[model samples]
Target chain A: MKKIIFGIAFLIFFSFLIVSAINMRTFGEPAYSEMDDYFIENAQSETGANNVVTSVVFDYRGFDTLGEATVLFTAVVGVIALFRGVKK
Target chain B: MKEMSRIVKTVTNFVYGFIIIFGFYIIAHGHLTPGGGFQGGAVVGSAFALLLVSYGSLNSQKFLKKDILSLFEGFGLILFIVLGFSGLGITFFYNFLANSGGWFGNAAVIGVNPGNMNTGGVIPLMNIAVGLEVLSAFGVIVLTMASAAEFTKKKEKS
Candidate 1:
C-alpha cells in the first residue's frame, strides 16, 4: 500500500515539474526587462563596481542580502539552542 | 568525536591556511570578482569544518568558542545596519560615497576595463559585514551540531 501511494505521488510530482519546465521562458531573452537594460548600461558608472553581479547584489539589492544574513543568523541560533546538551 | 587519522590531520594542517586565505581574497575582491561575502564566508567556514573534523572535539573546542562566534556575528550585523544608516542623508543602502572622490568613491569607466579595489562605494563595506556574519554563523552551526552528536553518542553509550 505504501509503495503504491509513493509511486503515485512521485508520478504526480514529476508531471508537475515537467509541465513547469516546459512553460519556462527561453534562456537569456526575458519577456519583460526594462530594469535589466538600465543595470547593464549604468550599473558600472553608478555603483563603480566592475563586477556588475556584485554591484547588483551589494548595492542595488542590498536588502535581499541583508535578509539572507538574517536567515543564516537565525539558523545558527536554532542549531545552538537545539544542541546545547552536555555530553554525559 | 575523536581525531581522524594522522594523514588527515597532516593534510588539514598543511591546507587550512590556504583555504582561509582564498576565502578572504574572495571577500576582499568581491566588487572586482565573481564572489562576494556569503560565498567567500562559506569557503572559510568549510575550512573550519575541515579542521574540526580532523582534530576532534577536544582540540576543536579550544579554537571554536561559541561566545566568540556569537560576538563576531552580532558585530557584523550591527556594522552592516550602521553603514546603511550612515547614508540616511540620501536613503537606506544609498551609494552616497560613489563618485565623491573619497575612499571607495572613484567613478568607474562606463565601458570594459580592469577592475580597481577602491571603486565600489559602500559595497565593499557591506561585503565585509556580511562576510563576518556568515563566517561566524557557519562556525557556530557546525560546532553545535558536532557537539550535539558527541553528546548523543555518549548518551547512547551510557
Candidate 2:
C-alpha cells in the first residue's frame, strides 16, 4: 500500500513537472521583458561591464548580493559554533 | 580518517594550484565572463576539499588554518559592505566609478569587441571580495566538518 501511494505521488509530481516544462515560455523569450530590454541596451554604458548579468548582480541588484554575503557569513558562524566542542 | 592513497595525493598536489588559479581567473574576469564570484569561489573551495580529502583533516590543518580562513571570511564580508556603503553619496550600491576613467572605470565598448578587464566599476572589487569570502567560508566548513568526523570516529572506536 505504501509503495502504491509513493508511486502515485511520484507520477503526479512528474506529470506536473512535464506539463510545466511543455507549457513554459520559449527559451530566451520571457513573458515580461521590458526590464531585460532596458538592461541589455543600457547596462554596458551605465555600468561599464560587458557582462550584463554581472552588472545586474553587483551594481543594479547589489543589495541582494550583500544579503547573500551576510547569509554565507552567518552560515559559517553557525557551523563553527556547532563544532566548537569537537577536538582538532 | 586516513589519507587517500599516494596516487590521489600526487594527482591532487599537481592539480590544486591550477584549480585555484583558474578560480581566481574566473573571479577576476567575472565582469566579462559567464562565471562570477560565487561560482569561482566554489571551484576554489572544491580544491580545498580535494586537499582535505587526500591529506586527511588532521594533517591538513597545518596549511588550511581555521583561524586565518575565518579572518579572511570576515574581512571579505566587511569589504563588500564597505564597498556597498561607499556609493551612499548617490545611493546605496551606486556605480560611482563607472565611466569615470579612474580605477576600473574605463567605458566598456558599446558592443562586443574584446572584453576589457578595467571596465566594471565596483563590480570587479565586489567579485573579488565575495570570492574571498566564499572560498574561505567553504574551507572553514570543510575543515571543521572533517575534524568533527574524525572526533566522532575515534569516540565510536573507543
Candidate 3:
C-alpha cells in the first residue's frame, strides 16, 4: 500500500516538472529584459568592470551580497556554538 | 579523525598551495573574469577541507586557528559594511571610485578588448573582503566539525 502511494506521488511530481520544462521559455530570451539590456550595454562604462555579472553582483546589487555575507557569518556562528563543548 | 596515509598527505601538501593560489587568482580577477568573491572563496575553502581531512583534526589545529579565522570573518563583514556606508554621500553602495581617476579608476574599453586589471573600483575591494570572509568561515566550520567528530569517536571508544 505504501509503495503504491509513493509511486503515485512520484509520478505526480515528475509530471509537473516535465510539464514545466516543456513549457519553459526560450533560453537567453527573457520577456522582461530592459534592465538586462541596460546593464550589458552600460556596465562597463559605469562600473569600469569587464564582467557585467561581477559589476551587477558587487556594485549594482551590493545589498544582496551583504545579505549573503551576513547569512554566512550567522551560519558559522551557529556551527561554532554547536561545537563549543568540544573545544578545550 | 585520524590522519590519512603518507601518500595522501604528500599529495595534499603538493597540491594545497596551488589550490589556494588559484582561488586567490579567481577572487582578485573577479571583475575581469567569470568568477567572483563567493565562487573563489568556495574554491579556497575546499583546500582547507582537504588539509583537515588529510592531517586529522588535532594535527591541523596548529595552523587552522579557529580564533583567527573568526576574527577575519568579523573583519571582512565589518569592512564590507563600512564600504557600503562610505558611498552614502551620493547613495548607499555608490560607485564612488569608478572613473574617478584615482585607484582602480581607469575607464575600461567601450567594447570587448583585453580587460584591464585596474578597471574595477569598489568591486575588487569588496571581492577581497568577501573572499576573506568566506574562506575563513569555511575553515572554521570544517575545523569545528572535524574536532567534534574526533571527540565523539573517542567517547564511543571509551
Candidate 4:
C-alpha cells in the first residue's frame, strides 16, 4: 500500500515536470512586452548604473534586494548558531 | 578516487589559478556583462573551496582565517546598508554625485564613465560588499563541512 502511494506520487511529480518542460520548449520563450524594452532603455538613467539587470535588481526593486539580503543574513545566522561549538 | 600524484597536483594548481582569475574577471566585468554580484561571488567562493579540497584544510587555514571571514560578513552588511542610506535624501539607492563632473579630474570626485565603471555610486560598492559577504558565507559553510567530515573520519578510525 505504501509502495503504491509513493509510486503514484512520484509518477504525478515526474509527469508534471515533463509536461512543463514540453510546454516551455513549445513556447520557446515568453515575451515581456510590457516593461522589458522600457526597463532596458531607461534603467541607466533611473538607476545611474550601466548594467540593466543590476539596475533592476538593486535600484528599481531595492525593496526586493533588501529582502534578499535579509534572507542571506538569516541563513548565515542560522548556520553559525547551529554549528557554534563543535571543536575539532 | 586514487591519490593525486605530483603531476596531477601541478595541473590542478594551474587550473585552479585560471578558475580564480576568471572568476575575478567575471566579478569585475559584472557591471558590463550578464554576470553580477551573486554569480561572480559564488564563482570566487567556489575557487576558495577548490583550494581547500586540493590542499588540506589545515594547510589552507594559513590563508583562510575565521576571524577575517566574520569581519568581512559584518562589514559587508554594514557597507551595504550605508550605501543604501546614502541615497535616502534622493531616492533609495539613488546614484548621488554620479554626475558632479569631477572635482579637479580626480578619480575620487567624479566617475570615469559617469554612468559606467569608475562610478562610485552604490552599484560598484554594493557589488564588492556582496562579493565579500558571499565569499565569507561560502567559506563558513565549507569550513563546517570540512570539520564534520574530519569528525566522522576520526570516529571511524577509533
Candidate 5:
C-alpha cells in the first residue's frame, strides 16, 4: 500500500518536471533588453566581483545567500550531533 | 592496509601538495572566478583523503585532529555571522572596508581594479568563512569514519 502511494507521487512529480521542461523549450531566445545590457556591462563594477554568478548569488541576492549558509550550518550541526550521540 | 612503495608515496605527496595549492588558489580567487568556498574546500578535503589512502590513517591524524577541526569549524561559523552583522546599518553583508580610504582598504583590495574588489561588500569575507567551515567539516567527516572503522575493528578483535 505504501509502495503504491509512493509510486503515484513519483509519477506526479516526474510529469510536472517533464511539462516544465517542455514549456521552457517553447519560449524563444529572450530578447536582450537594456537591463540585460546593463547587467553585462557593469556586473563587475556594481557587484565588486569578477565572477558574474558569484555577484548574483552573494551580492544581488544576499538574503538568499544568508538563508543558504544558515541551512548549511544547521545541517553540519545536525550531523555532528547525530554522530556524537545523545545523553539522557 | 597494504603497504605502498616509496615511489608511490612520493608521487602521492606531490599530487596532494598540488591539489592543496590549487584549492587555495580557487578559494582566494573565488570573487573573480567560477570556483568558490564549497568547490575549493572539497578539493582540499580530497587531498587529505589522498594522504590517508597513500600514507596511513595514523599519519593523517597527526596533522589534523578531530577536536582541532571542530574548533576551526565553530570559529568559521562565528566569523561568518560577525561579518554578516557588521553590514547591519547599510545592508546585510555590506563591504565596510570597500571605500574607507585608508591603508586597511588598500591592503584588503583585490583584482586589477582595487576599488572594485572592495565593492563586492562582504562577499569575499563570507567566501573565506564558508571555505574554512567546509574544509573543517570535511576533515571531521573523515575523522568520524576512520574512528568508527577503528572501533569496529577493535570489537571484532576482542
Candidate 6:
C-alpha cells in the first residue's frame, strides 16, 4: 500500500516536472529579460566590476548576500551548539 | 575515531594545498573572473572536510581550532556590515569608491579586455569578507558534525 502511494506521488511529481520542462522557453533566451539587458549594459561602469555576476551578487543585490551570510552564521551556531556536549 | 589509511592521508596532503590556493584565487579574482566568494569559500571548506575525514577528529582538532573558526566567522560578518555602514553617507551597500582613483577604486576596463585587480571598489572587499565567513562557517559545521559522529559511534560501540 505504501509503495503504491509512493509510486502515485512520484508519477505525479515527475509529470509535473516534465510538463514544466516542456513548457519552458528556448535555452539562452528567457521571455523576460529587460533587467538582464540593463545589467549587461550598465553593471561594469556603475559598479566597476568586470564580472557582472559578482556585481549583481555583491553590489546590486547586497542585502541578499548579507542574508546569506546571516543564514550561514546561524547554521554554524546551531551545529556547534548541538555538538557542544559531545566534545571530548 | 582513527585516521584513514595512509593512501588517503597521502592524497589529501598532496591535494589540499592546491585546493586551498585555487579557492583563494577564485575569491581574490572574484570581481574580474567567474567565481565569487561563496564558490571559493565552499571549495576551501571542502578541503577542510577532506582534512578532517582523513585525519579524524582527535588529530584534526589541533589544526582546526573551533575558537579561531568562530572568531573568523564573526569577524568576517562584522567586517561586511562595517563596510556597508561605512558607505552610509550615500546609502547602504552603495558603491561609493568605484572610479574614485583610490585603492580598489579605478575606472573599469571597457569592452572585452583584460580586467584589473585594482578596481571594483567594495565588490572585491565584500567578496573577501563573504569568503572568510563562508569558509569558517563550513569548517565549524564540518568539525561539529565529525565530532558528533564520533560520539554516536562510541555510543553504539558501548
Best by TM-score: 3
- Candidate 3 lDDT tens digits, A1-88: 9999999999999999999999999998899999989998999999999999999999999999999999999999999889888844
**Model 3 off-target regions past 4 Å?**
A1-24
DockQ score of candidate 2?
A: 0.83
Model 6 pairs in collision: none
Tell me the number of clashing residue pairs for each predicted model.
0, 0, 0, 0, 1, 0
Per-residue CA lDDT of candidate 2, range B23-58, in tens?
A: 999999999999999999999999999999999887
lDDT of 4 by residue, B118-146 (tens): 54346666777777777777777787667
Q: Candidate 6's residue-wise lDDT over B22-121, tens digit each?
A: 9999999999999999999999999999999899998999999978998999999999999888889988999888999997999997778789999999
Candidates 1 and 4 compared: the better one by DockQ is 1
Return whichever of 1 and 3 wins on DockQ.
3
Chain A TM-score of prediction number 3: 0.72
Clash list (residue pairs), candidate 5: B95-B121
- Per-residue lDDT tens digits of candidate 1, residues B43-67? 9999989989999977899887878
Query: Could you tell me the TM-score of candidate 5?
Result: 0.75
Q: Can you rank all candidates by lDDT, best first?
A: 2, 3, 6, 1, 5, 4
Write the residue-wise lDDT of candidate 5 on A1-88 in tens digits.
9999999999999999999888773454665568666766776655556676776766667677667667766776776676674211
Q: Candidate 2: where is the Cα deviation over 4 Å? A: A1-28
lDDT of 3: 0.93
Runs off by more than 4 Å, candidate 1: A1-25, A85-88
Candidate 5: where is the Cα deviation over 4 Å? A1-28, A31-38, A85-88, B1-7, B99-121
Candidate 1 docking: what grade? medium
Error of 1 at B57 (Å): 1.2
Each prediction's TM-score versus the true structure: 0.88, 0.90, 0.91, 0.75, 0.75, 0.88
lDDT of each: 0.88, 0.94, 0.93, 0.68, 0.70, 0.92
